[model samples]
Target: MTTPRKVTSLDVAKRAGVSRSAVSRVFTPGASVSDRTATKVREAANALGYRPNVLARAMLTGKSKIIGLVVAYLDNHFYPTVLELLSEALEREGYHVLVFMAAHTAHDIEDVVGQILDYQVDGLVLASVALSSDLANRCRASGVPVVLFNRKLEAEGELAVVSDNRSGGRMAADHLVSLGRTRIGHIAGWDGASTQRDREAGFVEGLHAAGLGMFAREVGDFRLPRAKAAARRMFDTSDRPDAVFVANDYMAFGVMDVLRAELGLRVPEDVAVVGFDDVPSAAWPAYDLTTIRQDAEAMVTITVSSLLAEIGGSNVTPPDPLPVRLVRRGTA
Candidate 1:
């Protein structure tokens, strides 16, 4: 069968007994058109099954109504939730999300971002990835609004939305210490992530304030296998910690699994555990992990609002970091 002919605005205008310009105005957002005329145009377009060409319209209006989202990985439970929230928020604002998964390397990010730019997205949100200085400068020069979500760049003049990781770290340390856990250890996330650095610093500071020090530390690189290996090394030692804090829930789950299944240790009894990013799994019957909540709702709301403002030329300065809270549960 042959494809049906495409319907055009002129056909709708003719059928609605109005000028083509009137139909164009009716289809364009924020364009001046009377309610009666818009209704007529809509009825005519429906009858003819005429859909406006979005690309052509974007060319005319100089706005794609598209937001590019760059994420390195979605395996982490926290990031998938954040991505869903961002998509919902952007949709509510009449924008579409174009997601790009970049590789771990800086060059990969730069290439992917360059491809995103080719689509002329209205704005960009970088999640859990940092852009190179050259790419950042290119984005700035292009005048496209760029916002970092759950990540921060050392370069000045870039917008970011993140949880107060330092405070969360301190809160975790304080809770473990309050339980009289003198030999407290830490399982850190990826070394290069800003979240990892801040959390570690705050935990160290909290331990010092309590007149104690870290009994042991290991890098998990935000992976489950590495975290399990770290747990094994820590627990197999003669000076095994009485308590431990894992940087995020993903790694926390691994540490907990090893403690219970492999090491035959009970949580909060043999080894009290605290984690970050109070992900949904943390509250499961299996883990029930006490953790620092990153306020996903608040983080997503601020990120969308900030990115929209930058896109609309209303705000340029980045907002302050949002606060985190300790969520009490069975663990620790």
Candidate 2:
């Protein structure tokens, strides 16, 4: 069988009795086009069964109209929320998102980013992951801007949008202390994560300021099973904590399940619990978890705007970390 030739923009322009540039501008997002010209082009395109070749246009215009997003994992409810918000926000600006998952290791992240660069994406966003200096430099050399969402780097000049985690930690600690819950324990996330380190540091600071010390500490590695195990170990002893501050809501749920279901303890009666990241599930009746709100909407807004700004050849100053607030519920 013989193959039919593919319809092209030139065919649409000829059929519309308009210049080829008119058809190009009509198809190009954000390009100037008169209403009459656009209508004619659309009608002609429909008759000819024509669509603009995005890859060819990208090669010519040097813009893929795509943003690459790298995330460590979406197991946490918070990340999925951020992803959805980010996709919506980017789509509003005529850009599409290309998502990739990578291990938390620097080498793995570097490999994932290298692959993203191969697609000629207009910009990059990293969530719950870090970018190596070498990879950062490579992205810069390629004129691809990067924005870190819900994460930060020790190295300066990298753009990031993160909640005030340290303050939130202190808020959790202060709340526990205000309730007269002494011997407060802490369940930490992956220590390598900046959120974990900052939250723990602030919690410890708050405890010291109140003339108290951490009664117990356990690392959960931000995994549900690990959090449950840590809870078991922390509460098994007779001299257990009366209150606990979990790093994030995802781990908080695991800890709560272990405490009530497995350990047969009444929440807030036997052990008051506080968590960070007021994720949607925190408000569920079953958990009713008190937590620090991370402002995912605000973070997503800043991330998309900052990335678009940098992509537009404008230098961007990293915004100050946004504030977090404590939300009281049955858990605490």
RMSD to native, candidate 1: 2.0
lDDT of 2 at 194: 87
Q: Give the lDDT of residue 40 in candidate 1.
A: 95
Question: Which residue window of length 10 is worst by lDDT in model 1?
Answer: 312-321
In the range 78-178, model 2's lDDT, one tens digit per residue, is: 99999999999999999999999998878999999989998889999999886787788788899999888877886668998898889999999999999
Model 2 segments more than 4 A misplaced: 1-6, 17-21, 30-36
Which stretches of candidate 1 lie above 4 Å from their native place?
Answer: 17-19
- List the candidates' TM-scores in order: 0.92, 0.94
Clashes of each: 0, 0
lDDT of 1 by residue, 114-163 (tens): 99998888999999885777788899789788888887876888788888
Candidate lDDT (C-alpha), each: 0.90, 0.93
